[model samples]
Target: MTGDNAVNIGSPQPPQKADVLARVCAALSAGDADTAKAIIDTDYPMVIGTKAQRRYTLTETLRTFYRDGFLDRYSGTQLIHPGALRTLSMLLPKEFPAHLNGKMTETHFAQWELFPTIDHVDPVARGGADDASNWVTTSMLRNSAKAHWTLSELGWTLHPPGDARHWDGLSSWFTGYLTDRPDLASSSGYLRRWLRATRVVQAERA
Candidate 1:
């Protein structure tokens, strides 16, 4: 962290994956459910169907715009399935060990490392407007770390937005996952609604 008037620290580098894991380890070791839940929700957001159905479909389409992949605007880390994050959060504390690992495993990736989140470029608390122009896609970890802080205060630079031509945020993988695990959506209203809405967009794009 630097002073408000500190010289440029260049772009903000994301904390090492090890550091993130260590933090989670500490929280779980202390049996801090609230802290852990905060981490889970911040990192892997669960859909709440806040957007109108048509709006949600449009949002998904923009996400898949040009088949662009997702990247954390602050850390530039690739993100994975939000649905998986929800599942991991549900299975946590009691089932924590099965997911924890020394090496970065698939479970860790989805739960901690690469879960996508939307971030406000300016702090809403500080009068940043709540609109798309003020928003950027980021990982959950970065979002939590940046809560209400300005980019200057954090010594972070805004990375260029992701181009779907190069990275599709593993969307193709998600589509395939849906095909292989249709039952997942059947059980999750969030997933079911997303599937229903995106299907319309997917067809149009096809």
Candidate 2:
């Protein structure tokens, strides 16, 4: 398959998620829920952790991804395209942001002991990348507040969202997360929303 058609999760690939992607795709394409159910049951372990941690079951994990706006295709508060949704993006390093912003002599932290999470300035729902340029350091509260909403859409006037110039730079350096995850792209209703927004902006500018 071409690079545009599938998510390339880097070679020396791991198992689990990759193995299920193919099976789920076939089931969905053929409208076979029975096959899909069987695939998920066998593919994703109901529990995780070496020390017998009772984490999310596959169903639970899928539900979370959909609820959290991670997947492009969601049904109310649940995932529709389990195959396309696949897995969450790889986590970034905690110190990586500090290192990237190293030129700054000062750093700000709103919450003590709160780990940094990667957040998109433009938002994937409104067209944004998943890489360094489009990413910003954020706490869980900030990230949750910013969930799937664009800076302009929310009328926020602080930090990266407040800075129009930063968003412009990110737009120029753009590569949407969906570019890598084509499965999500195929079902992303976000594209239509983005297009409508774009047309309105263009019309206003004109």
Candidate 3:
């Protein structure tokens, strides 16, 4: 597959939220629950350590960064969860902001541009192992664009991994947000899961 169909995550022009929603609607209408399900389940549990450890080392331990050279955020509230967007799109389309519906705007960044996901560097379809070594961190947008294509096929190159020492993906800010809005933890299992994992990692470092 050529990169022509891929959305340029590095570009100043973002993809339209309407376009993405339409894709999801089409997938669902066509009885392609798997596609809609994949779109809805964009959360990366590995980043937060909420996912169970594998028998071998995991790609989850890999440093987080946008493959396209954009800034990265920790896999937390800074990144919009697909579940949240799915709900809003269904119940509140009327109230959806014009900018979000028109062209993809800053509001959609959390959902598309910056949401971290694990991708197979060498796609499994082409015989790449489904293990840690073959996996890398990428934005949900790029992950979708890259569906089953190799880097050479797409004429893309792998960027270096990020160092937490320099950029912690606003992890400190996430900690502070949780502290200040503790009540949100009760309603959001996502927040609670990350909070627990964050504390565990912090304790280990301490």
* Candidate 3 stretches greater than 4 Å from native: 1-107, 204-206
Summarize candidate 3's per-residue lDDT along 22-108 as a digit string, tens digits: 777888999998887665445211122122223322112322222212232222222322233433443455564223342665243
Reference-based TM-score, model 1? 0.55
TM-score-wise, the better of 1 and 2 is 1
Task: Give the candidate number with the greatest TM-score.
Answer: 1
After superposition on all C-alphas, the RMSD of every candidate to the true structure, in Å, is 15.1, 23.3, 16.5
Ranking by lDDT: 1, 3, 2
Q: CA lDDT, every prediction?
A: 0.60, 0.41, 0.52
Residue-level lDDT of model 2, residues 10-93, one tens digit each, is 664545586697888899899998888888777764433122122333334322322233311111111122222111111232
By lDDT, the better pick of 1 and 3 is: 1
Q: What order do you get sorting by TM-score, best first?
A: 1, 3, 2
Best by lDDT: 1
Global CA lDDT computed for model 2? 0.41
Candidate 1 — which residues are off by over 4 angstroms? 1-68, 84-109, 200-206
Lowest lDDT block of 10, candidate 3: 43-52
**What TM-score do all the candidates reach, one by one?**
0.55, 0.24, 0.50
